[model samples]
Target: MSANAEDKLVIMNEEELKRKQREKLKKLQATGGNPRPARTLFLFNLKNPFRKACTSIVEWKTFKIIILLTIFANCIALAVFLPMPEEDSNNTNINLESLEYIFLIIFTLECFLKIVAYGLVFHEGAYLRNCWNILDFVIVFMGLFTFALDTINKIAGVPPPAPAVAARVTSQPDPAVRRKRRPIPLIPSVREADSEV
Candidate 1:
């Protein structure tokens, strides 16, 4: 084709691209600038108040730094409590457990906010799209599962299983172990174990 014709075609394409970009920017601004993603499993309308709030919060550097600090705090709490000798008072253990729950709740909120800001798995830039975010999602859900299991056992008045028993239950099942499993009591005979025994 002639050079003049090619130049005209190129100019038209560039103008069209620029116009599309401008339209996108206007739509974004109309929807609170940082609206929820499209094609989400749970719908958050463009005008959802939380959609913008969460997007802004998730994108904020200070919010990320705060989450990082909380994770570090959680690690320190685990380090301090996990290695405590058996002789440590029940109060100390309870305090540590409570602190752990608080940390878990904070992490859960972070996850929820991110899922709101980005979509879950369907949309571009979704939560599960990032490797780090997938890892975070798994960790948070596992922590939540553990919390629910503990709460259920407590409500059922089932004594916490022995460490070895708990380990066996979680690991690959052994036929021999299953055969020897005893029925868990609805109410433990003793509220506190005889640590001396």
Candidate 2:
């Protein structure tokens, strides 16, 4: 063969070899051949039953975490507003109010997004039947109650009462207001009635 033809043939063979190598690498990758050892705990396969159970419990979705965080925020707000001597100060009250307001806004937005993503039927409890759905409804309702209470208190020239305090004060029934029983009147006998007449 001519030197020029030989050089061209060598170049073509080299290109073909490179192409084959690339294809072989791709096939190995596709099959996960020669995988690197798992470096982290997450990559390791679960062998212990307890560890597997724990992993299953902790492997929650992003939406589930958001719901849990929303619930936790509201619970913290509730704890802040509880009728304790430590929380009765004006500064603490204001702080708690602001925290509650922020949590409510976040929860409201979260509910809106859930409704938009899942549609009205799903948001209204068409699918899931669990504690998360119940908590979502409660948080939304509590947010609305807080807004309404704030408006009413603003209009009435009074400070807004915390829900914990309001619930405690209203839930107690007065012990002094028990109804008295009326005495049954005895019927007079006929002879006694005649003598009286």
Highest lDDT against the true fold, candidate: 1
Winning candidate number (TM-score)? 1
Model 1 spans > 4 angstroms off: 1-36, 84-92, 164-197
lDDT of 1 by residue, 5-120 (tens): 99999999999999999998986776567544653447775457778688889899999999999989988887777443333346766888889889889999999999887879
Off by over 4 Å in 2: 1-67, 80-88, 122-131, 156-197
Instruction: Score candidate 2 by TM-score against the native.
Output: 0.39
Q: Which ten residues in a row have the lowest lDDT in candidate 1?
A: 81-90
Candidate 1 lDDT for residue 115: 89
Clashes of each: 0, 0
TM-score of each: 0.62, 0.39
Cα RMSD for candidates in order: 13.1, 19.4
